[model samples]
Target chain A: MKASLTLGKVTNFLGLGFFITLKDLFTGKLEKEEFKNFLRKTIVPLVSILLFIGLWHLGAKSLYNIEAKFKIEKALQDQGQVAADALKTCMVSGESSCQPNTLPSPSQVWNSFQSLLRDHNIISADKAAFIEKTAAMNEKRVAAGKAAIVYTGRPSFVDQVFTSLQTVFAGFLLALLIAVPLGIFIGLSPNLKSAFNWFIQIFKPVSPVVWYLLVFMIVKTLLIGSTEDSSFTISFISVGLCSMWATLVNTAMGVSTVDKDYINVAKVLKLGTFQKIFKVVLPSSLPLIFTGLKITLSVAWMVLIAIELLAQSPGLGLFVWEEFQNGANDSNAKIIVAMFAIGIIGFLLDRLMLMIQNWVSFDKTDAI
Target chain B: MAYLELNNICKTYGQSDGETEVLSNINLKIEEGEFVAIVGFTGSGKTTLVNLINGLIKPTSGTVLFKGEPVDGTSHERGVIFQNYSLLPWLTVGQNVFMAVKEAFPKKNKKELHEIVANYVEMVSLTPAINKRPNELSGGMRQRVAVARALAMKPEMIIMDEPLGALDALTRGNLQDEILNIWGKDKRTALLITNDVDEGIYMADRIIPLRPGPNATLGPEFKIDLERPRDKTEMNDNPNFKKTRNEIIEYLMDIGNERKSEAKEEYILPDLVPKDFVNQFKFGR
Candidate 1:
């Protein structure tokens, strides 16, 4: 019993308490108070979400009825008595007849999620089959001193998710690369800070769409003759430019406001300029810089959709846009699924950054 | 020859409009392995003087020489213990001391350096919390880490700027004894800057009073001739301790009175309840 208790304690400390708490509750080992606390934390949120879905379901059903009525009235006006009776039959026939273009039910969205997963799997299998079918031809071409043909099919939904992840990461990395050194440079000297201040102020508030246009123009010019796709480069540059300001501003602020005593400590230690910066300034300013980076990452994710939509890039953003334009029977439901996916992914990304920030920072207050 | 020397040191803040002279025409010399404390009220430029000695800041005029060499900038020869406990919050107590030890003795191997850090941490009885960050430690513990970090560097001289001023009385006295114990072992040249007169008398061989600013200067030096390893409670009974304490307090009081009179020179009365009402009240109308 003692051993099990210790194990429970260890798991709790490691933040893997959910499973252990569940097990303990089921096994009648958990105290009554703890079980109450667990229910309050977990079941409360679940019940609220269920309630939200119920309201959406009711609202959607009413909207669907309204749309059916509108279609009936329109048919009666266009084709007189005969069309009115036919439209009445269509409404009564339900699944076998015309369905109104209204908000999808919760079940429809769930079915869409499952269908997208199935589609992703089927598309992946098709790609595999295509690759296998082309293998012999490709081998012959390689032997005949010709380059092998590459598969150029549309990306699956899962593939699009990965593409969005990759794009955002690339953009975030580029932003960090540009912002940190620039921040340090501006932070170190008042002259440099003042020199860059006007440029920063003018450019910082410009929208990502404007940035995308500027990047697109430059990239189109540079890659005019090149066969390489320029969308990735254009989107990344725009994302980097739009998102870097938060990090840049925060890093400069953090660096400039580092405590004077720490600076004095550096001096008393006779630390060289390089050592002082790396040891004192950077470490001290890291909490604020991390905060900026978190903001920049979220900004990058937010800006990515517009860039992808405009650039016609293959990512989740483009996926959402394409689904909206598709306007098929299930497209609305698929779009709803995508919306939830984006929100959940954004929340997860923020949580991931928070975990890293907490790990790096000595101050526990920065955890939130 | 003095281990550290300040010849006609002067420091001024700003220029042209609103120029304030913090220190003026200060001359001091300290022999090798001597512990000296400069005591004064707040804004008396004791910190500025300590900064000058540590080479963290420069004197606007006059030369500060360490071992007959003119101080141009900061060096590893002087290590300072700041009042605010200048341990990097991100670094553990051990790491804070290790950083200084590593900087001071770059040639020392990793194991040897670790030993140095551990030794000093143990000196302050913070061995258990050596791996803890500054935020996790109490104020006294944080200050102890600061002390350990400064001492671990093993600088030629130690400069403390009110190191224990923020700590409670019990913690302050305990740390004072710990510091004295460490000092007794090596007898390194040390200068403590503080406003507490008794703290100066207890810790240093000589206590120097810095008169109130603006343009604060050293007033007089009171030597504490009490025996080594002095007991805090027993010091109350010691005649020499009483004499030194009285002398320093009397000097401080005189300077305090002088400052009050000087402030009165530029005094102006407010028109509270009207001047006529005050005159009427005075005349019992």
Candidate 2:
């Protein structure tokens, strides 16, 4: 039985791979040279980094004057000074850190990033030791009673990315659950629709900031009032509310515009209410509903980031804010990386939704 | 007793200034298994008369009786074939016919129902296009589907409101023969409303003419004592057919001429001139 199961699995995998390859070939997406170029570009950088580390291990790995290059050290020191000043001002006065901030240079930030990656056992034990040794030397200047300034203590970029992604998905799913059915109901009955129309119109155009503030206050009052929890709840609520509106409006419109003839046929056939809605009405309105959902998803993404910025939630928006405050340190380089990551992730999310939409779409022409 | 009766039926629309009377005191009786045709010019209340029979519209002052019971509204007992072929466009031809058959015989199993519907579709010669939608087929084929649907219902009376009027002449002739053949078999009571004199003469046992109307009434009934299984080529050679056709044509022509004269006078504008201006012009002359 086990052997047969293994054989079945292998066959299934081969079949899937064959079809995927065939599809790529048919669509003219299988450019071997381009794929090879991508592999070369990606591998070359990592290989170069490994070779650099090896070369350092062989030549002047120990007793190297880590800070003797004052030209580079001076530039790094100036950046760190600016970052410390900005952090002091923001923490002391509750001021924004976005005002005319100085940022660290690429090489300086790259050195710091390498050192942190090497020591954070949070990532690996050898890297954590390196980070701890660097931090022990650096923490002599940090004031007492403040948070510990351990160089090895920084959170992993991957962990931050995963945390943000999880929150976005959770909020998006909640919005979908609330919006789709509500939209269908609104679309079906004109009177019920009209009754709610004014309220939605008024609320839909309001800024995410307003929703964020409202949620913040409510959650603060009713739930555990820690800043992190409050911020997360507010950001989630803002995205949900804003995204929910688009879905609701679109769903209703799609349902309302479903062909009248189909409804008449349903009536003539004496289809039960459930059958009429699920089989006839829902299927016919799917295209419009999906269009609405796609728009809502995009809107929700933007709203989630904006709300996070306002609420100081632990996501990409919060990361951007923290980097802005730590203006001239390696944080600047981290911010740029975060921006790229956010953009790429947003695009992938939209493509994922589009794939789902196409899968569920009832277009007759799509039949095999 | 007549299988269907329209006794002194009058249908009017709107109030005094906007009043439009469609039918006026129309009296008619159709015996069981008899085929009758009502012929009229366009807008002459033929459709209204048919609607009255099918209970699509109620008479203002009179009653329509199907087997001596007043027709309150639409019913399964009276099958109607609309002029525009109102088949559910999404459903296939076989499905459209099957829908009616199912409604008429709800207790029948799926296999039996399918066979019955298929048989009727075969009778209409629409077996090939049974799976096609109305839009997919030609107008003539769509009407054939409509015929199949009505016939499958096996109603006591079938009412057709210009079912073949939209078809080409050749197709019309073909369907007319097909309808007559079907009528001959079951001898179900059938009433057809048409504008074609030859069609009425060819297919109906009796032809009734509805006069032109603000309030149209039945003008006369001509008994078509011709033998069944009518051949159009042979119909012209029959002396009685020729006489009856001519008589009906002449009656229609007379009515048309009278209508033209009345229309002309009603449209003629009276000249408006000042009396003093006319007197001054005469004096100057």
For B133-213, candidate 1 gives per-residue lDDT tens digits of: 899999999999999999998878889999999999999999999988888899899999998988988889998899877
> Retained native contacts per candidate, as fractions?
0.94, 0.00
lDDT by residue (tens digit), candidate 1, A28-130: 8878799887787567767999999999999999998899889888888998989888878877886523778779999999999999999999999999999
Could you list the chain B TM-scores for each candidate? Answer: 0.92, 0.91
Worst 10 residues of 1 chain B by lDDT: B271-280
When only chain A is evaluated, what TM-score does every model earn? 0.90, 0.62
* Candidate 1 stretches greater than 4 Å from native: A1-40, A136-145, B265-285
DockQ (C-alpha based) per candidate is 0.69, 0.06
